[model samples]
Target: MTRPSNMREWSARARAAGEAQAEPTGATLIRGARVLDPASATDRKLDVLIENEHIAAVGEALAAPARASIIDAHGLWLMPGLVDLCARLREPGATHKASFASEMPAAFAGGITQVLIPPDTQPALDTPAMLIRVQRLARQAGTLDVRMLGALTRELSGAALAELSALKSAGAVGVSNAAAPINDSRIARRALEYAKGLELPVHVFAQDAGLAGNGCAHEGPVATRLGLSAVPVAAEVAALRFWISLVEDTGARVHFCRLSTARGAELIEAALGRGLPVSADVAAHQLHLCDTDVDGFNAQCHVQPPLRTRDDRDALRAAVASGVIGAICSDHQPHEADAKINPFPLTEPGISALETLLPLTLQLVHDGLLSPLQAAERLSRGPAAIAGLDSGRIASGALADLVLVDAEARWTLRPERMLSAGRNTPFAGRTLRGRVRATWRAGRAVFRASG
Candidate 1:
């Protein structure tokens, strides 16, 4: 397979030339905003000139040139569009529940320009043909740039490995099975070895299925008080330990998806310290809520590998702050109302996050837990690196996929106003800061706030 040459530098040069010639008529100048590019490690107030979908310049007082579209960006923050590592757009067979067309608008509204889709779709994305079909569908849907993670095992049964080489060739960014934990160590080892040989990253939803049982909530006081089945923390910890061992043995790139327990973070940290090629992410919901939030037995809080204790939440946040956790994903699993309106045990797990991910993450910035750059790292560059995409940067010549945000802007999350088909979000009516004003993909304005 041929690797695409880096075109970011060339993209910048083209933008500059276009702006120089067009500025005499008029240029679109985004003035006086704080620009943060995590990849470049740049954080400062700068004026950005965008001409024909490329960044013409990123410095102080660049003239708008003639006839340019002027975007007043005072009190705004401009950064690369976020790249979400773990998002579930239930398309193909489950379009009635959620579709790429619906999820794209929500993703763009939340400042996510690119997303790595899970392998849990209908028919399961276990083959190269399936991966290509999804990519084509996403392009036709015109929401956000969507890449697929091929299934690690055929049918996601965890009994037999899929064709990793064929899947990668078909444009699968990585391989995963969503929350389908691999129970057979031998099968898991074979998958890892194949991934290593292909140099493709393997995304593992680390959790011991047997230990998790029929648990509906975190194994803690809340579950005991509510008389709910509990999913022990050991479930996640044990699975992560086994995954780390496999990663070390095969030297395969492994990504632990949405780690929800404190012990999970500790194990990941220890593996990283031991120089194992491992990386992990935490869901935005898990980072913000604890098992205590499940007091009412709300199914919205009923996520798989259920939310953990307060100590676990704090530890997860610290892991993110300390750089042990590299990315923050929406894990944006969307379900219909019927799927979630039932009792906790019978209802499906997960929530809609495409519209809520950015705001909730910015809450971290508001509370002084992370610098804007750090937030950008987790929201953009980190995920891009994991997916091996040439995005998540503001360097000249990079793909002009970017987002303009008003970090100080505050608003209430109203599910009724969302563009997503699924309205099962737990953050409905919650107030949040930071809103995306405009989003560009491949040098085109795919989304802009209607005012």
Candidate 2:
């Protein structure tokens, strides 16, 4: 087989390889591994056989043919690769901070086989042509499976709706304004109504600019004691209420992104209880950190919808456990070193997330907030469902997106070893228990940790 120079060609070769009638390809047997599939409620010691780009079989003590390659997994956990609902690649225009080529490896290393990139770049992906360009770039980069979210409004200005139908046809899994808020309720209603007509899901980050003002930290004692501007929790609650009401009126499939407040989750739960077609997600950082993390002006702790109080953090975790919040997103915003050079309030609000997503989530499992199977559901199955993708599962004939994790492995996060161009992670030097040993995308190994 000839090596492909670009991602498009690489995909062609892979497809052709899968289609070969008489190629007699060798199967890969992952033996003695604990197979965990949250989608099917499966948890048992089993062997997985992968042939080409699909799973061949999954059962106990599976037979391996002479032409098969065997990997001993005596104590490892094999599960579906995580599906990230929100991540910032910073490509096309913000390569100084991150690009698909850089962030993809980091994502794979963290056991994320698929990610949905938001349209928040310098030149937003509002047009079909722009979406095509990004898809082409991702294919050429050939790191992992990446799908772009088309901008809900043109250039994400939230002024007028973009061509949602065209963008969806161009391979946008969904439409979103990302962190950009639509101030005009009329425009927001129109966008949702249009999206409902097209049967496309709209993902939004709810924030009331008027209520948030210039604040960077959550309005609480921490902010008061630290002498930083406060963004009241009311900002999130009010925005969520407005969006949910719009969903009820328009019957649109809406997804709330990066929800940070306790009251915010309560609002979402109430909407869900009312049978409104709405789903929501909380960033992994928000599940662990709180306003106190920014007490000493720590810029890394500063993030959009800034970390709320401990009560909020606990509520978010409980929401995840109770199935109110279905997905966990990295909200992986990567920024250059200089972006966080200023004081806490002046610095950019984000955390370098891809590399730390998995371990941090495992921390939840250790704390009894979520079980291993529940963690897998929130990390993989839930996100996949939200994105309308047929991934994040391990089954017969399913796409072989899998990850091998050592749940007891102890490791420390170091900025020097990160693959993302942005090194502004708050988890630096934090010791984590779980670690990714290997990640496979479509039956092909994409990442392997160092021995």
Candidate 3:
């Protein structure tokens, strides 16, 4: 499909794709579930009724509608299905590691109904054609809502501005360079100005190429002892300062992705305090792990914005608690086993985190850092506002996208038992509390775990 000139046309194409996400099926009633909707600050017992593709009603016990399939939700927590801001579904060319068939269920099992993918896929999503292809492929997956982030530079090469207007018209929610670097600050300023004109938010990775050169681990005592090339915290802090200046000057909205440093989070908090039209999200894994996790050259812990000190992790947790970090995402990048089988420095950096996003976020609650309501806001509502998606809520007339969670259920993470095709997860074999009992999208059950 060619790039349209306006959003109406783009929206029409989106409607076409959404047609496959659900049929106008019969009604369903979830009874006696403790409903938690962070958007409305709602937390109470409610019986939710679903008809067709939207929530028909939500209140105390309403008589079940005729022909509705009734679910016994006693002791279950019914909340809006998660909206993950950063999840890499390896489609369009990286099927050697993952595919829509594998990752979709992984997302559903984790209670994720929507995902925002970056532009760093194989071949990169730099054109309207590429956007349309992923949209079509997601429709075929039939279990997830996918939004694309357009490449800030053509092919994410950090050279020239891409077709930003064309990308917006083709349904890109925002633009980013992904994990790739913007080597030139002049180019970064131009990007913010250009996206501002179109009102598109620029997603910043916030790491300077010069400060982060060829490093495999965080510059800390741990890396020094391990004899690994070290990446200093200044790499993230300097890049964030430059981008905040651009946002302040250009009046552009910028969302920092996977911020991994304490001082960088302080900079972002200051930017927000000054009302600079800036926001930020942290990956869930960063809040729990630190440079210490890489002590033995464990490749599974290798990630962009290499995990820093325990103090940094504590500060990040506090930031999220104090509302400095607006969202928590899974910086999920899946790789084949061979990709991580080599020597530590040579191994690709990432974690197959689709199945662990929600559980990890809930961990903050278990640790007394974030309340359950705060977790819902960070995981669902916060990312929704950042991406400008009309989702991440449960109310009358809203889309019937929801998750049934057994918040007290205990489970173990076994890569071999995971639905994701890639078994490259650092959380493997760890036990965790809370599990998704079922996931529904547009009034139809996408995934329901067997008892």
lDDT of 2 by residue, 93-127 (tens): 87667767667777888899999999987799999
Query: What TM-score against the true fold does each predicted structure earn?
Result: 0.92, 0.94, 0.94
Q: What is the C-alpha lDDT of each candidate?
A: 0.82, 0.86, 0.86
Order the candidate numbers by lDDT, best to worst. Answer: 2, 3, 1
Candidate 3, which segments miss by more than 4 Å at Cα? Answer: 1-24
The predicted structure with the larger TM-score, 1 or 2, is 2
TM-score for candidate 3, please give it.
0.94
Best-to-worst TM-score order: 3, 2, 1
lDDT: worst 10-residue window of model 3: 1-10
Better of 1 and 3 by lDDT: 3
* CA lDDT, candidate 1, residue 318: 93
